[model samples]
Target chain A: MSTTAVVTGLGVVSPNGLGIKDFWAATKSGKSGIGRITRFDPSPYPARLAGEIPGFVAEDHLPNRLLPQTDRMTQLALVAADWALADAGVTPAELPEFDMGVVTASHSGGFEFGQGELKKLWSLGSQHVSAYQSFAWFYAVNSGQISIRNGMKGPSGVVVSDQAGGLDAIAQARRQIRKGTALIVSGGVEAPVCPWGWVAQLAGNRLSTSDEPARAYLPFDAEACGHVPGEGGAILVLEAAEAARRRGAKVYGEIAGYGATIDPRPGSGGEPGLRRALETALADAGVRPGEVDVVFADAAAIPELDRAEADAINAVFGPGGVPVTAPKTMTGRLYSGAAPLDLASAFLAMADGLIPPTVNTEPSPEYGLDLVTAQPRPAEIRTALVLARGQGGFNSALVVRAAD
Target chain B: MATKEFTLDDLKRILREGAGADESVDLDGDILDTDFEELGYESLALLETGGRIEREFGITLDDDVLTDARTPRALIAAVNALLGAGAAA
Candidate 1:
């Protein structure tokens, strides 16, 4: 609506891959990151599988100064932030302190940190509790630490509304850019694969308990049981499109428009809010249903939720018109990190001219949408619509135009 | 009424343990000038320590005690002062 804000740089730390290059390669190859839950002991629970990042060493990316100050979630965000800034070709010293900012989306702030402190309290008693628990576990820690580390005093905020927050964050970041901020580091990450995080997710009762890692999170499939929770997220560098051009930065794609609404809970027919979000996003993008070349679906994997989303897409793009893909089948649902990673995937898809497959998904008659499955498809993608819904009643849609 | 005093070592232990089980902390640093933030002590650590102090001395420590008692020496002083005041009342 204001100065065009494009995702100029991207950094991803996902289960299937470490960075954008590796992630997209694994995504196109249809590799699965799901495995028996090793982050914590999942033996007690039926859902023992997760899409966890393999062999993530914190010392590799983060500095020694941040070692004591961060939780695993914050560390991942910080590392991704570094990669994003580097990818954007903007060094910290060049930017004005008040011009750059950070906004992060999160579902669970630091369950793993809290879990460790809780263990100390229960086992070793009060004297052994760690002070780091206070800073590390809060939901907004990533934003605070990132801002502090980057010296960005610009207007910033954190959204804890749920997974839909990822898209919402981009929407908010674009607003900041439009309001005259030069660069905003936005996106999200989660490290909820730990025992406490897993137990909390287990209480939600939506995870796939299947022993098979490959098919654990097949969104839009008749055999879809439920989603596997995963780790990692992408931190994106959103800059004014013109500024990126002036700086000769590589523009991934512009976030044309975004829409956000509430679920209004169980009994609502037509799921009007979701439909409205998608329609609003398309309209804001100045893009018609036909103009939307591809869609990155929320892919809830819960039959009714998945159907609701498909029906929403059908209502907007017409049934089977827009090619839909849920590449999350490989990495599982990263909660607040999911849609942003999907947005990252959309950026890659727009750049590479390929729609990555939804790993193990096989489209059935149940969902009347063109679900990209099995293998990557070569296509000319222009405008891509990304959809997301939070467990706590938040529905959001974002539209991205191809970089070319 | 009897007032209890905490040793400098005990206060140092609280500050060290508050940082969690990781890197080293400055235990023998300047008390008046050094803030808790220098010790990598965030608000959560202060809150945990405040609770522990309350439980240990059986006296209620206000949340602002950390900001007020920034260093190990000052913290021990704050604990004894709070305990003395509690015994008086």
Candidate 2:
């Protein structure tokens, strides 16, 4: 068999919780983190609510030196990477730097950092801008910074498919592992809650304007509106199964399979890419539709997107064939961080035998999904599929199975 | 010639604000001749420090001059040279 890629460690920074322990606890209990935006004044904006990670003082998690040089997104990612490496019990000094790699996803590269520099350039003179802005605002800086910090000299790259980028980056890491790299640090973390980022997201026209926290980001609901944008995400450590077994590391699950596709041009008489992405992932994993224990849905929360996702699920696994959950309803859609967070939650669910609830959604029966909502459900979940779609027609699917 | 001399104290302050000292290093020591890299300030940090110095002193240092000044003493000398030349001009 080809080298199997397995997840050995997870580090989460979510609106509901900072690490895996608190995040999983809150997720399984159906606690919602969506609230009024406190990072900046949202009174001027239509969509005023978001899932911001509360009480996160970057200085508490990182050294003061990094504070001036990094943006919030990079700082959060660096912390997540540290936590993941510590959780895996792997020391960079002990491992061969050439055997390790990093692959992460990013949607918007340091919007707040760029905006701040731009403000200085416009108000003051060009000379007032900080030189750090050159690299801080680049999308690939997360991967570069993590690689430099860990001394990982192996294959490294960043994916930019928006929300789908999370899975795409993980899948890329898995590919590297299969190609003989011993370990890869993968996943994404995003912090786009600043004024500049909010305006950019507002341009998408897919954010909930509802001021009520509980009802704002209802996905797959009769009153479905739109997703609430959020900050933070999860970072995971992926290692080759053989290497993990040799080290006697605790394996969370295997990154069994992944598939992605792009929708055709709007005027093209072609089908949407979600169904194909699902079918391809199932085939890639050598898994039948019936074997999947649960699905962590994309849950865009828009009526048309929800219907399309529901239709795709029905066509693939049959209506109500498998239980579906949108745990993101609690933390809001994390953009590049969304799918990886779902992947992490899937592993946690498998370990605990509890499917986390999709909070605040009264799944409209029209979707034909056995939607898990309002409360956590106990199940024998050995296999899971995670789905994510990005704006302007990007679709990705990943299947993770419990490792023996 | 210049209004006031740019002392080692000013360089220390700028260095701390620009890149911050490494946890193991001390900024208050008598180490004016120490290499910037050993003191935990890399090229980028020095570049930022140079920018601040230019803005604060109202005198621009050449990019080459900044890159060549790898120690606190060298950087201080470079800034003082620019200040004297600006005053003369």
Candidate 3:
């Protein structure tokens, strides 16, 4: 049985919005969600701005029993998973337990939770620590929690490749479905807004210190400095195409192809792997450069990374050949959550026939690409390629095509 | 100075503060005889509650406190036994 993976539902917990309706609206209109960090006093940090989800109280959406055991990220993931399953019209009680599984990406695992516990351990003693800390701080907590909550006992896993892990997790879910899992909940959601997570992010020196929200994160522009970090992301429901059709599930798009590569050691003088990863994904999807309607760039917002990405796009699609956009400019880079959100936006674009804009960026002419900025463009987007690169040379590419 | 006794009221407050009561389970009604699990306080919840009790009351609870005291009344008795022992010392 040749199984194909298709996206049946999308759950978004974005800095700009809590659900798909709001997220898509904000994306389409190019509204910025970036603002001063209110989760903590940012005065202690160099980069003060971030994209944070507004008005999300866990108690409103989850059970009281779950509050103490879960971190904020896990709470968000559980809610997103619930929304995605509901959007896909999936009732876990009705489905076979072993047929469904969960695959998710986590970059910083329960940092805020760990930070709180560590404070107690230092000030009070080890006996003061909560026993829940043992599993809550694990990177696989999201996947485990989601699986446990839904009673999904099938093949489940968590990918931890930093930013690239989102696409990688979705691809892993696709792989699992192809191997016989009927349905999988996949993608990434992150909440690294606390003081410890902030200091850790600042250590990378890749965060833009710009205080102005509109100009904080500018990818593919001359004024580009560093990317803005943000919280929240997207979760997706992926099902085997035949099973979805049999159940009469609404299809968003097909997860056509995936490719991943790691860049060479910094001083090794080897070429960057972003171009090869994109090419490999296109080949895997049997898509030519001309067939791809749009490219969702990694958009590192650093000069060298931007140059490499532009060169990769230009190398494969040719200069000014395809329209490139970084819709993340509106929501800030969500670390492991970024690419999956872009994937969600791609599916939405195909459905709406409107390409979301990469707001607030004036593309540098040197890139020689047709960059979409400041406004949404109407187009028949059948195939979209999403790219992501992690901190330590992890590069991943995924291709999605409108459902047949 | 006399050590304050650990009571059912204190356990009720800690249960609510540490893990929160289940919506269906009432913390106010006579719950002293109810099992911690029946009150929606699982092992982890009890562990957290014990941690809070230790901090607020300045007492060291044995790790098996939850295992030994399955009900609210038993937990309070165990805590007061420790308090009475400390006062005598």
Candidate 4:
């Protein structure tokens, strides 16, 4: 028998807000974090709008002496990790360092620090560059920094498979717990607002260039174009159900099932790989299709991609249409942090028995999915399926059940 | 441009701006003793300030320079050494 992995504590540092309270309030109110870029000058780029985290002072959370050694992505992760640890009431001094681990996901690594270092190396000599630049911009920097700060000496790793990697990290953490690790801090954080990262994303033809924030990302709508990029999202604190129960921890939800599939050819409309992923996840969770209460879709906002997702949901839930929504439209896309945030939102929604609205969606009956829009709907949500697909062809789905 | 000597006040002012310190704080005396958390400066802000200083003065600072130069007076001396190195080059 497999050990169930339950989310004992939750923390978020997203564009929506800093902590779970603020994030939940803002998300329920249908607020959009997308706005003009403040991190760097976007004069040259085609897309000017993004879901940048506002008023994040890293020093408020990190210590004074260790500030120079960590990157912005790491700083964000540390903040969220601290909150999760506190919420779980597990202090570093109280717990055994060997039992706790950290697994994080990053899509673009540390773009801001990397951009700064590259600029310095180009204009000035190599000797002028700070030594901290060597490790700050790497994808694994967040996991490394978090582990070092909290004295978490257990297994630490990073996933680099883009948006899908967030959900994959949670799945990996669940595996860790079953393998005898006590706790796992699993999530993702992204800081891709730098000019170079934006330029790289522009080449993908999936970025929405709409000047208006409301109209920027409209998934499943006829006016769909593409997704807007965002920064700063994370959720942490997962433990074995038995271990958490022994510790008298507050269980948020259970990571019941996880399934992932890749379409060899992306953007072809050739096959619905998402259907297989959804079906496989339900089978893994031992739940039937009719038992799924809600779905958190990928909602890429490209016309073809949206249609594929819509078709997948219809095929899974049948013609009755399951209540589906995509909150990514509000925060743009967090890349590595996208699905973890989605999973967190799903867990909260199931716990609270409320379905969050899909922001900025027009009324369209043709899509065939019941999209909750404009207002929160009360529902007895027991199970939620969170879906995410990366830029190239990576597709991931996770099934989370409410802890009774 | 001729090698310009950076005064203690100049370095303090740059650090204060980079750290997002309040305007009321004494640039010369308060900056040296100010903690990183109190000044709202993190790794990214420090790098940005360091980059700006290197570009403006045409000088490169080593890791030891940042570690050793905690006070405004010490930073000014390090800047002077870098400026001297640039002049010799």
Candidate 2, residues A1-404, lDDT tens digits: the string is 78999999999999999999999999999988899999899999999999999888888877666778898999999999999998888897799999999999999999889999999999998999998998998899889899988899999999999999999999999999999999999999999999999999999999999999999988889898998999999999999999999999999999988899999898796888999999999999999999999999999999989998999899999999999999999999999999999999999999999999999999999999999998999998999999999998999999999988
Model 1 per-residue lDDT tens digits across residues A70-136: 7788988998888888888889777899999998998988888888889989997765566567668
Residue ranges of candidate 3 with Cα displaced over 4 Å: B1-3
Q: What is the full ranking by lDDT, best candidate first?
A: 2, 3, 1, 4
- In terms of docking quality, how is candidate 1 classified? incorrect
iRMSD for each candidate structure, in the order shown: 5.7, 1.2, 1.6, 6.9
Q: How well is candidate 1 docked (DockQ)?
A: 0.18
Tens digit per residue, CA lDDT, model 1, B1-89: 65687777666665454434224554575554567677666666677667667666777776677677776667878888877787788
Residue A400 error for model 2, in Å? 0.2
Model 3 lDDT per residue over A1-404, tens place: 45899999999999888889999999999988999999899997899999998999999998887888889999999999999999999998899999999999989989899999999999989977877898887889999999988999999999999999999999999999999999999999899999999999999989999999988899889999898999988999999999999999999999998999999999898989999999999998999999999999999999999999999999999999998999999889998899989999999999999999999999999988788898999999999999999999999999999998
Question: What docking class should model 4 receive?
Answer: incorrect
lDDT against the true structure, each candidate: 0.84, 0.92, 0.92, 0.82
- Please give, for every candidate in the order listed, the TM-score of chain B alone compared with the true chain B: 0.72, 0.91, 0.95, 0.67
Q: Which residues of candidate 4, in runs, are more than 4 Å off? A: A266-270, B1-89
Candidate 2: chain B TM-score equals 0.91
Evaluation by DockQ, superior candidate among 1 and 4: 1
Clashing pairs in 2: none
The all-Cα superposition gives candidate 3 an RMSD in Å to the true structure of 1.7
**Lowest-scoring 10 consecutive residues by lDDT in candidate 4 chain B?**
B17-26
Per-residue CA lDDT of model 2 for B1-89, tens digit only, reads: 63657889998888778766676788898778988888877789888998988888888788998789888889899888877777777
* Weakest 10 consecutive residues of candidate 1 chain A by summed lDDT: A263-272
True-vs-predicted CA distance for residue A94, candidate 4, Å: 1.7
* Residue B37 lDDT in candidate 3: 82
